[model samples]
Target: MTSPTTPGVPPPVVDLDLGGRTALVTGAASGIGRACALRLAAAGAKVRAVDRDADGLETLAALGTEAGGAVEPQVLDLTDLDAAEAAAAGADILVNNAGLQLVRPIEAFPPDVFHTVLTVMLEAPFRLIRGALPHMYAQGWGRIVNISSVHGLRASAFKSAYVAAKHGLEGLSKTAALEGAPHGVTSVCVNPGYVRTPLVERQIADQAAAHSLPEDQVLADVLLKDSAVKRLVEPEEVAEAVLYLCTPQAAFITGTSIALDGGWTAH
Candidate 1:
């Protein structure tokens, strides 16, 4: 079955060419990260797919090969800030897509989990950008796409850590844009609401339990409560936004977020 196009926003027709460019995508083993890696590779970029899940990375590599795209799998944990930074060196495009989520009230949230979320979601992106800027500055061009979320713009109960990290990411993305603009680099956030990813899938039961509802009800009433469209955003759709941001036509766009929230933020 085909998915419906976002209303009013026509499907993108821009032709992207990333020939001779190297793109580094964190958490490329699955979901939005996997989609973005494949999309960029199909556009002729040499993609470095990073993730701690070696098995998942293998699957992504095979998928890329089947699609006739160059995907080099790098098994690394994003929590290793230094390694994450080093992996981004020489990248023409950097997609900071690695993330984790925990749905718990601030009082109930584990401190370690919160720390892990911040380290991976916020600090690592900072380090990765710091590493990529030198090469990007030298070439006078680069694209940095941070996979933020609607949580960055609005708060939801029982998602303190994820919301906090995403909010911090928004600021970090803007800061990168400010610093990167002079070097011809653009930094932007792709804010998706409840993507159809493993992360969200795992949250279904957690959200159900947290909200005292069934899983299905959690999806329809809790997750989609604020979204007028009443559907989870697809990973490929988010990848397309990332692709669009990397195109020459998007050179003038920076320091802002492109919300793929199915009108969740429109509320």
Candidate 2:
């Protein structure tokens, strides 16, 4: 990669800041959501971390303190409509990041798995966004960052449920953006390619079993095959994109899907 400006000159700048915002991040106990929470808190936002795992949320709060960020942990499941509404009670920024992945051929997929994935990735986001509408409308400003995946834009074999749910969530986000635009609210979905996390790490063994390959080979040959970067994307990288969207500079940006896929979707 090369800079477009003169080699000796500094590139143009974007002053991205998220100070004085109240944020609610779902699935914030770990992975990309936790990373976003930490980043926002560091940027001086009062972050409310929401997750089902109490222990993980506590750990995230500690990490925020360690980084000198303001964060409060909340334990609840977005799958419950009332809980979803209550979680976003006073949030100006919402990051709908909770998700689940299942690896199964379509014929082998059951309704339970499909419903579970859809509920988390699609329905939950919809419920929360709908719940937060009045609050944002009252304030006349907000940012809704839907954390989707590259799978939402593109698909691979044996990920039917997850892909479907993500695709739906992307559509939902677009519609939300269109409706929220005139009200000074903006919505965008950040789609990233394969990320190295505990959930993704769990997929190694599953991939190994499904493809009849060793775990190491699954990581090397399967997941990295179409990734131009040739490495698993860091959770913090996705968080950076989320942080960017939350800034005043991105106030004009909405209703678009941003791919942080490391060229996986470029071709």
Candidate 3:
């Protein structure tokens, strides 16, 4: 008899074919969004990479060119809710990944910043989903992946705006899943812990200041303190999870969150 494959020795590899599909990814100019945009395009989908950073988008498009993937950069700020909705029109796969963060105690948090976070992370996704659903329902297939955070499931201090926005996104994702089930559409959330993104890099300073810690101590002491894995998750790793959700194998895996938090929530 052949020996059984060792558990977790070599991770399972997924092969997906998304030929002729169109995917829209927000915040596609950098970090997790950029990774997802390229990953989807590599699977033969036409990826509409949306971001406010024109230069970053150009770089992303160029990277796609090197990968022999299709990436169409769309420069638009998600704060413009109407524009966000319009951009999602005719998308077969929608990845709502655009977000901003402000690290301050609830009392010290700027009301305007909180409002902006809600607009970009929650309302914009609602509008985009609303815009994408009609075409998806007509075609009988769709995927909506929200790039949430471990914060969505749990809470942390000094991150009022981000935590609230992510929690709202979780509810929205689940509701979309229920409504879209019969229409052959699926909505899911990919919740990651501290990712090795520019956003997190910038946060180190803010977090250090907020927690009264040295910059170097922020990662291990603050970010990864509750995580079983003592490392930041790579953007490519999160992108892989996003790609898997778009695969046919994940058709039934809707209305749920796939946590890529390295056992952060296990605690």
Q: Number of the top candidate by lDDT?
A: 3
For each candidate in turn, give its C-alpha RMSD to the true structure in angstroms.
6.0, 4.7, 4.6
List residue ranges in candidate 1 displaced over 4 A.
1-13
- Residue-wise lDDT of candidate 1 within 36-127, one digit each (tens)? 99999999999999999999999999999999999999999989899988999999999999999898988999999999999999999999
TM-score, every prediction? 0.94, 0.93, 0.95
Global lDDT for candidate 2? 0.88
Q: Candidate 2, 94: how far from true, in Å?
A: 0.4
lDDT (C-alpha, whole model) for all candidates: 0.93, 0.88, 0.95
lDDT by residue for model 2 (1-267), tens = 656476644345655556778999999999999999999999889999999999999999999999999999999887786788777876899999998777888998888989888988898898889877788888889999999988889988988998999999899999999999988899999999888777798888878888999888997798888888888899999999999898766888899999988898888
lDDT of 3 at 27: 96
Candidate 1 accuracy as lDDT: 0.93
Candidate 3 residue pairs in clash (backbone atoms < 3 Å): none
Worst 10 residues of 2 by lDDT: 8-17
- How close to the true structure is residue 206 of candidate 2, measured as C-alpha lDDT? 76
Could you give the candidate ranking by lDDT, starting with the highest? 3, 1, 2
